[model samples]
Target: MTRELTPKGSATRQRIIEGAAAEIREHGVAATTLDDVRTRTGTSKSQLFHYFPGGREELLLAVARYEAGRVLSDQQPQLSRLTSWRAWEEWRDVLIQRYRRQAWDCPLDAVVSQLGRSTPGAQAVLTELLNRWQGEIAAGVRAMQEQGEIDPGLDAGQAAAALLAGIQGGVVIMLSTGRLTHLEAALDVAIQHLRESRDRHPADH
Candidate 1:
């Protein structure tokens, strides 16, 4: 079983994770070393081991989880407040701008790729992130349904899943081709479909 960390220990571990993430971002995951992370975080070798006894692989997984959280957190208040059409548009724009700014250098992708996606640890981290993301989007769709802005008959979870898949596909394409068009189209078309659903059930409204 894993031992629970005290507040200070937890803070130190998070600091190390953040510092390591920064080092990986600046130096690339393959080039980064535990010593580099130690220097960046101002932690001793023993101290580092105390937090991550599994060593580099363990630290990398922790960093992967942190970066995954960032993927959603980056969208912020807009992502959480998707109750209005305007709010959804804002969220979409934020998501687009985020990827546009990051371009090909995605920290989450880098870490996960380095960790090997098929690895159980990496798969768990990604699976959790996607599930959380889909849940939030489904909640937003249900909000629209409650407001009579979406077709009540439509399956919100399925719609959200489709949108999430499109977003992932768009991101992959953008990463490979360095073009944001696909991502933009994905977001626009998904949102358009949701909006058009209202027209499909005019009598229900």
Candidate 2:
């Protein structure tokens, strides 16, 4: 069983994780060492071990979680308030701008790759991130439905899932090709589809 950390201990642990993420971001995950993290965070070896007893892999997982949180947090208030067409457009623009700024460097992907995508820890982090993201999108869909802006009979969960898949695909392509066209198209098409559903089911609204 894991021991619970005190407030200060939690802060120290978070500092170490943030430092490690920065190190990975600067030097790439393969080149970052525990010592690099320690030096960056001003943490002693024993202190590092106290918080991450599993050593490097454990610290990497913590960083992975941090990066995962950043993925959603970066989207900000727009992501949470997708109740209207304008809000959705703003959210879409924010997401695109985030990736455009990131370009090819994806810190979360790097850490996950280093940790082995098949590993339980990495898989759990990814699954949780995707589930949370999809849930938010589904909530947005339901909100539109309530406002009579979307078809009442449409499956919000399924629609969200498809849209999320498209976004993921576009991200992968952007990472490979350094182009935002696919991602933009995916967001635009998905939102357009949602709007068109209103036209198709006007009577239901």
lDDT of 2 at 187: 97
Q: Over the stretch 68-89, how does candidate 2's per-residue lDDT look in tens digits?
A: 9999999889888999999999
Mark the regions of model 1 whose C-alpha exceeds 4 Å error after superposition: 203-205
Encode model 1's per-residue lDDT on 1-205: one tens digit a residue: 2789999999999999999999999999999999999999999999999999999999999999999999999988888889999999999999999999999888889999888989999999999999999999999999999999999999999999999999999999999999999999999999999999999895354
Worst lDDT run of 10 residues, candidate 2, spans 196-205
Q: What TM-score, to 2 decimals, does candidate 1 have?
A: 0.98
